[model samples]
Target chain A: MSGTSMTTRAWLLLLPLLAVMVAVIGWPLADTVGLSFTDAKLVGTAGNFVGIDNYVKTISGSNFQRSLITTAEFAIISVFAEMVLGVLAALLLNQQFYGRTVLRGLMILPWALPTVVNATLWRLIYNPEYGALNAALTQIGLLDAYRSWLGEPGTALASLIVADCWKNFPLVALIALAALQAVPRDITAASLVDGAGPFSRFRFVILPYLAGPLMVALVLRTIEAFKVFDIIWVMTRGGPANSTRTLSILVYQEAFSFQRAGSGASLALIVTLLVAVLAAAYAALVRKTAGSNA
Target chain B: MSALEIENIRKTYGAIETLKGIDISLDSGEFLVLLGSSGCGKSTLLNIIAGLAEASGGDVRIGGRSVLGVHPKDRDIAMVFQSYALYPNLSVRRNIGFGLEMRGVPTAEREKAVLETAKLLQIENLLDRKPGQLSGGQRQRVAIGRALVRKPQVFLFDEPLSNLDAKLRMEMRTELKRLHQMLGTTIVYVTHDQIEAMTLATRIAVMRNGRIEQLGTPEEVYDHPATLYVAGFVGSPPMNVLDGVATGEGLRLDGSDRLIALPVHFKNAVPSGKRVKIGIRPEALRLVEDDDRQPALKVAVEVVELTGPELVVTGRVGGQRVTACLPPRTKLAVGTTQAFAFDDDALHLFDAETELAFGR
Candidate 1:
C-alpha cells in the first residue's frame, strides 16, 4: 500500500477515540472556559457574560491565594518526604534478610487501599478521644494527654500529609526497587574492590541507576500531591478555618458548596495551568537525567 | 612471602559444595590462570581471594597477612570484570580514578595517576567519554586502566576479554601479556579458553567440579598432562584415547585382532590382561606408508578437515574414534584406510578404572 492510504487508514482507526475525547473532554473544557467569563449558577438560566470579571476576582481573592500556598506547601513537603522514605525503604528491602518477600508484599497494602478508605482509617487513628496514635504517644511518655488532631488547625494539615505519604510512598519504593535490581552485580563488586565504603558505593555506583526511575516517581507524586482533594475532604473537610484546604478542595467548595460556578471554573483553570507548568519542568528534568544516564 | 595464598578454601550453598578445598599460592609477579569450563568453581576461588565472597572454610592471605574476614576494599586487590563494569555515569578518567577518590587521594594526584594509567592503556583520548560511548575494545582498555591505577598487591581478572569480538580478543590478549611484562604485578586470571591459558599464564590451574584437576606450567600442562581430564582439555583438536588390554608380550586392541607393542618402560608396569587407555595428541600422530618400519595402527578414515596449517583427520581405530593432524598438502580422502604412527615418547597411559596416568 502507498503511504498516503496508510496514513488515511490510521486516521480512520483513530476517529472513534477522537470523537469520544471531543465529547467527554473537549466539550466540557470548552464549556468551562465559557462559564469562567460569565456569572453562572449551578441550576438556573444562563447568566450574562461579564468578560474576565470572574478571572480577575478569582485571582485577587484570599481563598485562591491561601489555597495556592497551602497546595504548594503540601506538594513540596510531602513529595520530598515520600521520595526519601521510599528510597530508604527500597534500599532496606533490597538487602538479604529473613522475611523479605513477605515484607515487600505487605509494603503494598497502604498504597493498595482506596484513598477514601485510607483517609477514614487515618481519621480513627488521629481521633482526639481515644485514637490509637494518641494512646500510643501517651503510653510512650511522649504525650501528656490525648489532644485534638484532625479537629485542630495547627496539626490538621500535617496529619493529612502523613496520611497521604503512607498511602503513596510505596509506589515510589516499588519503582526504586526495580531499578536497583537492574544494577549489575559486577559493577558493585568492582566498586567494593576499588575500596569504596557502603556510602560511596551507593552514591557513585548505585545512584546513577536509580535516578531516572526515581525522577519518574517524583514527578507523579508531586503532581498528585499538588492536586490532592479526596483524602483531605474525607478526613477533615478542609476543616478548622480552612487550614488544610488545597486547590482541588477550594474548587469543590466554590462550585458545589457555595454554588459560585463562574469563579470556581476560573480558579480551577488557574490551578490546572500551575500543574501543567510543574509537569513540564519535571519532564525536562527527566529528559536531562535520562540523557546523561544513557 | 607469597603475594597471594588460598589455604584449603571451601564454599557450600545449602547442601551443595561449590569449592571443596582449593589451595593455591602465588609468588609476586607471577600470572596464574584458573582455566576451566563454566561451573568449575574457578570464579568462586577468585572471589574468595578477592574477599568478594566469604569462604565457608579455610583462610585467604595477601602479602602474608590473613584476609579471611577483611572487607574487599581493605584487601589490597584490584579486579577487572567480564562485563568491563566501568561506571557508566562517569567519564573514563573518573572511572579509572574512582578508587583513589574513594581513598581520599588529592585531586591533582588522582588526575595525574589517572592520566598516566590512561596513557599506558592508550585510552588517553577516551578519558572524556562515558563507557556507553566507547567501543567494546575501548571499554576493555578502560577496565584495565581502572585496575592498573591502584597498583595493588594482587590483580584478579575474571574472563576480562571474553566480551570482545575474536579479533579484539586477540589484540587484548597481546596487550595483557605486554602489561604483565611491564608491571610485573602478581595476577590471577580466569578463562575457559585453553589458548588463552597457554599463551598468557606462567602457571595454569585446570579445574573440574570444584577441584583442581592439574596445576603446572603451560609447557608442563601441554606436554605432560597429569590427569586424563587435563590431557583432553588442554589441546585444540584434543587428545584421543584408544582402549587396549595389556598382554604378556604386547597390548591387544579392542574389537580388533592387532597387537601393538607398548613402550619398554610400560611393558612390566601393568599386569597381564589389564585394561588401559592410551592417549595420543592429534599432532603426535603422523600418516605413514605401509612399508614404514615404525609400528602403526590401521585407521578407517571418516572425515578430513583442512585447517589452514594442518589437515585434521578423524577416523576409527579398534572401535574408538581418534583424530590425527597431518601435513596440510597430504593426500587423504574419506572412507579410506590409512596407517598412522605415533612416537613412543609421546604416548600417555592411564588405568581404565582410575583414569590416572601411569608411571613411566
Candidate 2:
C-alpha cells in the first residue's frame, strides 16, 4: 500500500475518537477563549466585544497574581513532600515481610478515596473544638493548647498541604514502587558488596533508576495541584483574606462568586495554558529518556 | 585459614528448600565454578556467599573472619551480575568509581583506580559513555571494571556472560579466564553452561536439585562421573548409556544374543548373568570396514551432521539408537547401513540398580 493510503486508513480509524474529543474537549476550550474576549457576565443576556480587556485585568489584578504565586508554591512544596514520602513508603513496602501484602493494600486506601471526601475528612480532623489532631496534640502535651488548625490563617495553607499530600502521595508511591521493582536486586546487592551503606545504595543505585519515574510523577502532580479547587474549596474556600486561593479557586471566584464570566474564562484559560506547558515539557522529557534507554 | 569457607550452608524460602547443605573451602586466588542447570541453586549459592541472601543454616567466612551476620557490603566481596546491571544514568567511569566512592575512597584515588581498570579492560575510550550508549561486550567490561575497582577479598560472578550472544560469550569467556590469571584473586563463578564450567573452573562443583551432585576437577568429573545423572548431565552430546547383561562369554547387549567382549580393566570384575548399563562417549565409537568388524554391530544410519572438523553420525544397532563421532571427511548418509564398533577400553559399565560406575 502507498504511504498516503496507509495514513488515510489510520486517520479513518481515529475518526470516532477525534469526534469525541472535538465535542467534549475542543468545543468548550474554544468557547472559553472566545468568551474571554467579550464583556460577558453571569447576569447578562448578551455580551459586547472587548478585546484583550479580560486578559489585561486578569494579569494586573492582585488576587490573580497572588493566586498564581500560591499555586506555584503549593505545587512545588506538595509534590516535593509527596516524592520524599512516596519513596520512603515504596522502600518500606518493597521489603519482604509477613503482613506486607496487607500493608501495601492499605496504603492505596488514602489515594483511592475521592478528593472531596478526603478534603472533608481532613477538615473534620482539623476542627477547632473537637478535632482529632488538637485532641492528640493536647494529650501529647505538644501544643500547649488546642489551637484551631484550619481556622487560623497561619496554619491553614500548610494544613491543606498536609491533607493534599496524604491524599495524593500514594500515587507517587505507586509509581516509585514500580520503578523500584524494575531495579535489579543484583545491582543493589553489588552496591552493598562494594561497601555502600543504605543511604549510599539509595543515592547511587536506587535514585538513578527512580529519576525518570519521579520526574513523570512530579509533572503530573504539578499539573493536578495547579488546577486544585475541589479539595481546597471544600476545606477553606480560599479562606480568611484569600491565603489558600490557588489559580483554580481564583477562576471559580471570578466566574461564579464575583459573576465576571469573561474574566473567569480568561483566568481558566491561563491555568489551562500553564498545565499544557507542563504536559508538553513532560512529554519531551519522557521521549528523550526513552530514546536514550533505547 | 582459607580465603573463603562456606560450611553447611542452606537456604529455604518458607517451606521450599532452595539450597541444601553446601560446604566449600577455598584457598586464596583459586577459581571455583558452581555448575548446574536452571533452578539448581547455583545463583542462590552465589547470593549466599555474597551475603545478599542469608543462609538458613551454617556459617560463611571471608578472609578467615566469620561473615554469617554481616551485610553484603561488609562481606568484602564484589559481584558481577548476569544482566550487567549497569546504572543507566552514569558514565562508565562513574560506574567504575561508584564502589570506591561508597567505600570512602578519596576522589582522586577513585579516579585513578577507575582509569587504571578502564585501561586494563580497554574501555578507557568508553569511560565517558553511559551504559545505554555501549554494546553488550562493553557493558560487560564495565561491569567487571566496577567489580575490580573495589579490590574486594573475593569476586563473585553470577553467569556474567550468559546475556551475551554465543560468539561474544566465547570471547568474554576467554577474556575472563585471562583476567582471573592476571588478578590472581579468589573467585566464585556460577553458570549453567557445563562447557563454561569446564573451561574456566580450577574445580567444578556440579549441583542438582539443591544438592551438590559431584565436586572435582573438570577432567576427573568428565572421566569418572559419580552418578547416572552426572554422566547424563555433563559433556556435550552427553555420554550414551546402554543396558546389557553379563553372560558366560561376555556382556550381552539387552534383547540381543550377541556377547560383546569386556576390556581388560573390567574382565576380572565382570560376573555372569548380571545386568549392567554401559556408557560410551560418542568420540570413542568408530566406523569400520565390513572385513574389520570383530566386535562390530550393523546399523542403519539415521542422521549425519558435519560440524567442521568432525562428522556426528547417529545410527541404530538393534532396537537402540547410538551415535558415533568420525573424521570430517567420512562419507556417511542417512538411511545407509554401516558397521561400527565401540572402543572396549573406553567403555563405562555401571551397576543398573545403584547407577554407580563398576569397573576400575
Candidate 3:
C-alpha cells in the first residue's frame, strides 16, 4: 500500500474514537480553560478577558497554600498505609485454607460499597456521644469521657485518614491479589527446594513478581487521593479550622458555597496541573520499568 | 536403600479416580520415565513425587526416608516446568542464583555456583539480560541452570521439551541425556512421547488411567508387550488387529473363509470357535510365492505411499484393508494385485474380551 493510503486507513479506523474524545473531553476542557481567564460566572452569557489576574491571585492565597499541603499529606499517608495493608491482606488471602472463597467474597464487599455511603457510615461511627468508637474506647478504660473524633482539630485529619483508608484499601488489595495470582507456582516451588522459608520465599519469589502491579497501584491510588473530594467532603467538610481541607474541597467551596468563580476556576486549574505532574512522574516510572525489563 | 520408592500410590479427585494404584522404585543415578497419553496421570505422579501434590493412599520414600509430610522445599528435588517459568523482573543471574541465595549461601559462593552452572549450560552471555530478552532455547537453558544450581538429590522434569520446536527439542533431548550422565543423579521424567521415553530412560513405565500398564526396558516393551494396549501404543502406525475365530488348524476370519495357522502355544491355549484378535506389524508382512509350502493369502493393492525410507502399501485382503511396508525402491503401484504372507511364528493372538495378548 502507498504511504498516503496507509495514513488514510489509520485515520479511518480512529475516526469514531476521535469524535467521541472531542465531544466529551476535548471541548469541555477547552471551554474550562477559556472560562478560567475571564470573569464569567456560571450563569453569565459573556465576560471580558482578564489575563494573568486569576493565576496571580490563586498562587498568592493562604487558603490555596494550606489546602495544597493538606492534599499532599493526605495523598502520601493514605496511599502508603493502603499499600502496606493491601499487600498484607493479599498475602494472607493468597494462601490455601478452608473458607478461602467466602473470605475473598467478603473482602470485595468494602470496595464495592458506594463512597458516599462509606463516608456516612464512618461519620456515624465517629460521633462523640454514643458512637461505636467512643463507646468502645470508654468501655475499654482508654478514655474517661466521650471525645468527638471529627470535631477536634487534632483528631479530624486523623479520623478522615482512617475513613479514607477503610473506603479505598480494598482497591489496592484487589490489584495486589491479581499480581499475586500471576506469580508462577513452579518458581515458588523452586524457591522452597532451595531451602527458603515462607518469609524468604515471599521476599525472593512473591515480592519480585508483584513489583509491577505494586507500582501501578501506587500511582493510581496517589492520583485518586490527590483529587479526593467525596468521602472527605461528606465526612468532615474540611472542618475544625480547615485542618482536613484538600484542593478538591477548596475548589467546591470557592465555586459553589462562597461563589468566588474566578478564584475557584483558578484553583481548579492549579489542581489540574498538580495532578498532571504526578501522573507524568508515574508514567515515566512505569515506562522506565517496562523498558528496562524488556 | 534405593534413592526413591513409591508403593501402591493412588490419587482421586472428587469422585473420579485418576490414578488407580502405581508402584515404582528408582535407584541412585537412574533415569525413569513415566510415559502415557494425556489424562493418564503421568504429571500427577510426578507432582506426587515432588511433594507438590499428596498421594491419596500411598507412601513415597526418598533416600530411605518417607516424604509424605515433607514440604516441596525440603524434598531435596528440583523441577523444570514446561513453560520455563522464569522470573520476568529479575536478570538471568538473579534467577539462576535465587535458590542459592534462599539457602543462605554466601554471595561469593552463590556467584561462583551461578557462573559454573551458566558455563555448563552455555548461557554465560545472558547473565545481565531478563528472560524477555532471550530466545526460547535460552530461556529453557536458564530454567535448567536454575535447577542445576540447587544440586538436589533428585531432578524432576514435567515434559520440559514439549514447548520447544522440533529441532530444539532434539537438541535439548541430547543435552538432557548428557547432563544425566555427568551428574549421575536420580531423575523421574514424564513425557507422552514414546521416542523420548525410549531414548532417554533407563526404564520406561507405561501408564493408563493412572495405573502402570507395563514397566520394562525399551526393547522388552517394544518386542514383548504384555497387553494389546502396550503393543498398539508403543509403535508408529500401530499394530494392525483383526477379529477372528479359533478353528481346528488355525484361526479363521470372522466374516470370511480365510484361515491362518498359529504357533503351538496359541493353538493349545486358544479354544476352538473362541473369538480372538490377531495382530501383525506392517513390516512383518512379506511377499510370498504361489506354493504349497505354507498358507498364503491374496490381496489387491489399493494405494502405494512412497515415504522416504519405506513404502507403505495399502491393500484389501478378505474384504478388509491391510497395510504392508516394503522397500522404498520396490516396484509396486496402485491396483496391482499381489500375494502376501507372514511367518506363523510372527503372529500375535489376543483374547478378544480382555484385550490381553495370548502368550506363546
Candidate 4:
C-alpha cells in the first residue's frame, strides 16, 4: 500500500475511539473549564463571566489550604506505612512453610472487598460504644473505658489512615511478592556464600530487585490516597469538625452540598493539577531507579 | 593433609535419595571434576562440598577440619555457578568485592584486592559495568573474579562454562586450566562434557544414580574403565559392546555362526560356551586388509561421516551396530563388507550378568 493510503486507513480505524472519547471525556472537561471562569450556580442560569474569580477564591480560601495539607499528610503517611508493611508481609510469605499458599490467598480478602463494605466494617469495629476495638482494649486493660475512635478531631484522621492501610496494603504485597519470585535462586545462594547475613543479604541482594516494583506501587497508592473519599465519607462523613476532610471531600461539599458549581469546578481542576505534578515527579523517580537497576 | 575431604555424604528429598553415599578426598593444588549427565547427582555433590546444601547424612571437611554444620560463608569455599550469579545491581568491582565487604574488610583493602583479581582475569576495563551490560564471556570472567578474590581453601565450579557458546566454552576451559595451574588451589568442578572432563581434570569422578561409578586420573579412567557404564560414558562415539559366546577354540558371535579367535590371555580366562560382552573403542578399530592376521570383525558399512581429519564409519557386525574412527583418506563403499582389526590389549571383557570388567 502507498504511505498516504495507509495513513488514511489508520485514521479511519481510530475514528470510533476518538468519537467516544470526545463525547465522554473531552466534552465534559471543556464544559468544566468554561464553568470555572463563570459564577454559574447549579440548576440555574449560566451566570456572568467572572474571569478567574472562582479560581482566585478557591486558591485563597483557608478551606482549600487546610484540605491540601490533610491530603498530603494522609498520602505520605499511609503510603509509607503500606509499603513497609507490604514488603514485610511479602518477604514472610515468600519463605518455605506450611499452609503458605492458604495464607497468601487469605491476605487479599481486605483488598478484594468493596470500598464501601470495608469502610462499614471498620466503622463497626471502631464504634464509639460497645465496639470490638474498645472491648478488646478494655479487656486487655490498655484502655480505661470505651472512647470515641471516629468522633474525635485528633484521632479521627489517624483512625481513618489505619483503616485505609488495612484495606489497601494487600495490593502492594501482591505486587512485591510477584517481583520477589522473579529473583533468581542462584543469586541468593551466592549471597549466602559471600558472608552476607540475613540483613545484609536483604539490603544488598534482594532490595535491588524489589525497588523498581515497589516504586510503582508507591506511585499508585499515593495517587489513590491523595484522592481518597468513599471510605472516609462512609465512615465519618468528614465529621468531627471536618478534621478528616480531604480535597475530594471539600470538592464534594462545594459542588453538591453548597450548590456552588463554578468554584467547585475550579477547585477540582486545582486538585487534578496537583495530582498530575505528583505523578510526574514519581514517574521521573521510577525511571531513574529502573535505569540504575538495569 | 588433604585440602578437602567429603566423608560418606548422603542426601535425601523426602523418599527420593539424590546422593546416596559420596566420599572424595582431594589434596591441595589438585583439580577434581565430578562428571555425569543431568539428574545424575553431580551438581548435588558439588553443592554439598561447597556447603550450599546440607548432607542428610555424613560429613564434609575443609583444610583438616569438620565443616558439617558450618555455614557456607564459614566453610572457606567459593563457587562459580552455571548462571554466572553476579549481582545484577552491582558494578563488576563491587560484585567481586562483595564477599570481602560482607566480611567487614576495609574499603581500600577490598578495592585493592578486587582490582588485582580483575587484572588477573583481564577484566580491569569492565569493573564499572554491571553484569547485564557484559557479554557472556565477560560475565564469566566476573564470576571467576568473585570466586578468586576470596582466596578460599577450595573453589567449587558448578558447570560455570556450560552456558557459553561452544567456542567460548573451549576458551574458558583453557583459561580455567591455566588459572588452576597458577593458583594451585584445591578445586571441585562439575560438568557433563567429556571433552572438558578430559582436558581440565587432574582426576575425574564419573557419577551415576547418586553414586560414583569411577574415579581416577583422566588416562586411567579412559584406558581402564571399571564398569560397563563408565566405559560407554567416558568416550565420544562411545565404546561398542557385542554379545558373544566363548567356544573351546574361539568365540562365536550371537548372530553369526563363524568363530573369531579370542586374545591369548582371554582364552583361559573364559571357560567353554561362557557368555561375555566385549567392549571396543571406535579409535581402537582400524581398517585392515582381508589377509591380515590380527583378530578382526567383518562389518558391512552403512554410513561414513568425514569429520575433517578423520572418518567416522558406522556399520553392522553380526546383528550389532559398530562404529570405527579411521583416517580421512581411507576409501570404503557403503553396503560393502570390510574387515576392521583390533589389538589384543584393546579388548575389554565384561561379565554378561554382572556387567563388571573381568580384570579390575
Candidate 5:
C-alpha cells in the first residue's frame, strides 16, 4: 500500500513534465515519421501509403544531392573558419587591456541579435548597388568595379558563408575565452621559465585547455550550419540558379513551394539522419580525444 | 662570484608597494630560503629573480651577469610552482623534457636527460603516465624533475610543497633536502613554513611587511631573533612576550602590581622610565622543581591540547594570551595557576617604541 502511494506521488511530481515533453517533442516527431511514409500532398485528398517511394524519390533527385553537398561544403568551411577566427579573438580579448571588460561585453552583439535580423543586415551590406563592402573595396582599389556579391552564382555561397560566420563565430569565441581563463596562470608562467617562447607557451600550455571547448563549440556550430535556412533565405533565397541552396532550403522548397509534402518530409528526415550521423561522429571524436589524453 | 645576486629589487602597484627594495646574494651552492608570513613579498622577490615578474627598480645578476631585461626563459633559471603546474596534456617524460626540447636539445639526448632526471627522482616507472595519474607527491617530484632537467644556473621554488598533505609534505621536505645535498645547486625558495626554511636553507631571510627582518642561518634566527616580530613569528607555539616598564634595577611587569621582573643586562643604559617587551621562547621557560628564580608568569591554564607527541597549553601570561609546549603527562588542569621560570640567556628584550632587539 505504501509503495503504491509513493509511486503515485512520484508520478504526480513527474506528470506535468512528461505531458509537456510528449506535447512539444514526441507528437511532432511521430507525426513526421508517419508523414514520411505516405504520399501526403500540401493540398489534396487524403493520401495513401507510399511505403518507401517518397524516400527513393527524395534520394535519387540530383537537386537533393547537390543541396546535401552544398550544406556539407558550407558547414565544413564556415565552422573551420569560425573556429580559427574565434580562437584568435578569444585570445586577444583575454588579454589585460585598457577597455578589455567593455570590449568583451560588445564582442557578442552579433550573436545576441536575432538570426533573421543578422541575415537582413548582411544582405544590405552585400547589396551590389550601395553595399559598404563594394564601396570599401572600390575605395581601397581592390576592385575595379562594384561586382554583384550575393546575386552572382560564383560568389553567392562564399558571401553567404562569410555573413553566416560573422554572425555566429562569437559563440565559439565566448566558449574558447572561458576555457582560456581556466588555463592556470602558473602553468603559463612555468612554460615561460621552461624556456618556451610565446607561441610555444600557447601551444603547449594554453592549447590543451582550448581543445575540449573548441570541439564542443565546433559541434554546436556544425549542427547550426548544417540546417542553415534564415541567412540564405534573407541574403540570396537560394538564388542565382540555386548556387547557395542548402539541404534545409531544398527541403522547405520541396514541401511548401512545390507542395510535395510526402517527399519533402522524407527529404527532411534524410537531412536529419545525415546531421545525426555527423553529430554522432563528432561526439565520438570528442570522447576518443578525451580518452587518449587521459 | 655569487651565483645569484639581487640588487635593490622593488615592486609596486599604483599606491601600494608589494615589495620594498630588497638586496640579497647567495654563494654558488647555497640554498637560500625566503621565509615569511603571507603578504611579506617573498614570492614576489623570487618571481622578480626568475624574470617572471618585472621589478619597479632593481638589477638581478646571475653568475655576475646582469639579467635586467632578459626574458624568464633566457634567465638560466627554472621555477617549481606551488600548484605543480605540470602540463596536463603531456606525459611525465614529456613534461620533464619540455625545457630541453625548447632549448633545441637533440631528441635522443633529451630523452636520455629526462630518463636520468626521472631515475634520480625515483619516478622512472611513472614516465608514461600523465600528471593526472600521479599522486600529489609524485606530481611535485615531476615538477622538480622538469626544473632539474633544465640544468639552470639557479632553481626558484615558490612554496613548492604547499599543496601537499602534512605527511607527504614532511616526506617531500626530506626528499628536497637530500636532492639539494646531491645536486649542490644554488636554490632560492620562498615559503611561509618555518620548518621548511629551517631544515632546507643554508640561510633563511625572515621577511615582514615586504622587507627582510633578519637574514641568518636557521640556528641564528631561532636561537637569536633580531626583532620583536621575528621572535614572535619564527617559532611554533611562538615566543611569549611580557610588556613592562623599565625600573632602576630591572623591568617591572605590571604598572603597579609588579607581577614579573626583567633585568636589563645590556651595558647601554636603558632609560629608567622606558617601556620594554621581554620575549622568551615558550620552550625556554622551565617548570621548576625548586624555585631558585622567581617565575616570570603565574597564570591559569585556558586550553589544553594534546598535539600527538606533546601537550600544548594556552594560558594568560600577564594579561596576554600565550602558548606553551609542556612535557607529556605534565598535569595541567584547565583552571589551575602554575609558575613557569624564564631562562635569562634565552630572554629576548626589545625596546617597545622601536621594537628592535635590545639584547638576547
Candidate 6:
C-alpha cells in the first residue's frame, strides 16, 4: 500500500480506542481545566468567568491547606509501611517451604478484592459495638472495654492508614517477588562464599534487584494514597472533624455537597500534577536501574 | 600438611547417590583437575570442598583444619564459577572488592587491592563498567579476578573456562596454568574437556559413575589407562579393543584366525584357554603393504578422517571397528583392503571378568 493509504489504515484501526479515550479522559480533562476559572455553583445561576479567583481562594483557605498536608502525611506513612511489609513478605515467600504455593496464592486476596468491597469489609471489622477487633482485644485483656476506632480525631487517621496498608501492600509484594526470582542464584551463592552475613547479603546483593520494581510500586501506592477516597467515604466519610480527609475527598465535597465546581476542578488539577511528578520519578528510576541490571 | 584433604565424601539425594565415597588429598600449591563427563559428580565434589554444598558423609580439611561445620565464607577458599556469576549491578572494581569490604577491610586498602588485581588481570580499563557491559572473555577474567583478590588457602574452579568459545578457552587454559605457576596456590579445577585436563592438571583424577577410576599424571593416564572405562573415555577416537583368546604359544585372535606372540611369559595371568579383550592405542597402529610383516592383519578400510597434521582411519577387522592414527600423507581409500600392524609391545590385555588390565 502507499504511505498515505497505510497511514489512513492505521488511523482507522485506532478509531474505537481513540474515541473512547476522548470521551472518558480528554473531554473531562479539558472541561475541568476550562470550568476551574468559572464561578459555577450547585444552586445559583452561573456567574461570569473569574480568572485565578478560584485558585487563589482555594490556596488561601485553611481547609485546603489542611487537606493537602493530610494527603501528604497519608501517602508518606502508608506507602512506607506498605513497602517495608511487602518486601519482608516477598523475601519470606520467595524461599522454598511447605505450603509456599498456597501461601502465595492466598496473599493476593487483599489486593484482588475490589476497593469498595475492601472498604466495606474493614468498616464491619472496625465497628465499635460489635467489631471483631474490639471483642478480641477485650478478650485478650489488652482492652478493658470497647472504644470507637474511627470516632476520635487522634486515632481515626491512623486507623484509616492501617486499613489502606492492609489493602494495598500486596501490590508491592507481587512486584518485589517477581524481581527476586530473576536474581542470579550464583551471585547469591558467591556472596556467601565472599564472607557476607545474611543481613549484609540482603543489603548489598539482593536489594539492587528489588530497587527498581519497589520504586515503581512506591510511585503507584503514593499516588493512590494521595487521592484516597473510598475507604474513608465508606467507613468514616472523612468524619471526626475532617481529620482523615484527603485531597480527593475534599474535592468531592467542594464539587457536589458545597456546589463549588470551580474550586474542586482546581484542586483536582493540582492533585494530577503531583501524581505526574511522582510518575516521572518512577520512570527515571526504572531507566537508571534497568541499564545496570542487564 | 596437605593444602586440602577430603575423606570419604558421599552425597545422596533422596534415593539416588550422586557421589559414593570420594577421597582426595592435595599438597600445597598443587594443581589438581577432576576430569569427568556430566553427571559424573566432579562439580558436586568441588562444591563440597568449597563448602557450598553439604556432603552426606565426609570430612574436609584445608591447611590441616577441619571445615565441615564452617560456613563457605569462613572456610578460607575462593571459587571461580562456570557462569562467571559476577554481580550484575556492581562495577568491576566493586565486584573485586566486595569480599574484602564485607570482612571490614578499610576502603583505601580495598581500593588498593582491587587496583592491583585489575592490573594483574589486565582489566584496569574496565574497572568502572558493570559486568553486563563486558564481553565473555573479559567477564571470565573478571571472575578470575574476584577469586584472586581473596588470596585464600585454596582456589576451587568449577569448569571456569567452559563458557568461553573454543579459541578463548584455549587461551584461558594457558593463562590459568601461568597463573598457577606464578601464585603457587593450591587449586582444584573441574572440567569435562579432556584436553583441558591434560594441559592444565598437575595430577588428574579421572572419574566415572561418581568414583575415581584412576589418579595419575597426564602422561600416565594418557599412555596407560587403568580401567576399561578410562581407556574408552580419555582419548579422542578412543583406544580400540578386539576379542582374543590365550593360546599355548601366545594369543589367538577370536576372528580372522590371526596369531600374535607376547614378549613376556604369562606368569601371573590365568594360563592358556582364556578369553580376554586386547586394547591398542590408535597411534600404535600403522599401515603395511602385503608381505611387509609377520604380525600384520589385513582389514577392509571403512572411514578416513584427515585432520590437519595427522590422519585418523577406521577399519573393520574380524567384525570389530578398529581406529588407527596415521600420518596425514598416508594414502588410503574406503573399501580397500589393507594390512595394519601393531607395535610389538603396545598390546594391552584386560580380563573380561574384571575389566582391569591382566596381571603382568
Fraction of reference contacts reproduced per prediction? 0.82, 0.80, 0.67, 0.80, 0.82, 0.76
Q: Model 6, A60-126: lDDT tens per residue? A: 9998899999889889999999999999999999998999999999999999998889888877788
Model 3 Cα lDDT, one tens digit per residue, B1-360: 789899999999999889898899889999999999999999999999988888899999989889998988788888888888787778999989987787779999999999999999999999999988999999999999998988888889999999999999999999999999998978889999888898899999999988898999888777767778887888776776777888887878766686777677676788888898887778878777656466555668898888889989888777776788878888876887787787875678888999887777
For candidate 5, lDDT tens digit of each residue in B194-250? Answer: 989999999999998889899999999998888988888888878888787777666
Q: Candidate 6 on B1-360: residue-level lDDT in tens?
A: 899999999999998898999889999999999999999999999999988889999899999999997999999999999999888778999999888988999999999999999998899999999998999999999999999998999999999988899999999999899999999989999999888998999989998888999988898888778887777777877888888887777767777677777537344575688887888888888888777445666778999999998899988887878899999999998999998887756777877778887655
Best by DockQ: 1
lDDT of each: 0.92, 0.87, 0.86, 0.92, 0.88, 0.87
Report iRMS values in order: 0.7, 1.4, 1.9, 0.6, 0.7, 1.0
| Model 3: DockQ score | 0.61
Give the candidates in order of TM-score, highest first: 1, 4, 5, 2, 3, 6
Docking class of 4: high
Per-residue lDDT of B350 in model 6: 75
Instruction: Give the CA lDDT, 0 to 100, for residue B212 in model 5.
Output: 89
The residue-by-residue lDDT of candidate 1 on B67-108, one tens digit each, is 999999999999999999999889999999999999999999
Model 2 ranges with Cα > 4 A deviation? A1-20, B267-271, B290-297
Chain A TM-score vs. truth, each candidate? 0.96, 0.95, 0.92, 0.96, 0.92, 0.92
- lDDT (Cα, 0-100) at B38 in candidate 1: 98
Better of 1 and 2 by lDDT: 1
Off by over 4 Å in 5: A1-8, A279-294, B255-264, B267-269, B289-296, B301-308, B329-336
Compute each candidate's TM-score over C-alphas. 0.97, 0.94, 0.92, 0.96, 0.95, 0.91
Q: Model 1 chain A, poorest ten-residue lDDT window?
A: A285-294
DockQ winner between 3 and 5, please give it: 5
Interface DockQ of each model: 0.84, 0.72, 0.61, 0.82, 0.81, 0.67
Residue-level lDDT tens digits of model 5 in A103-182: 89999999999989998898888889999999999999999999899989999999999988898888889999999999
The list of candidate 3 runs beyond 4 A from truth reads A1-31, A38-50, A281-294, B290-298, B343-345
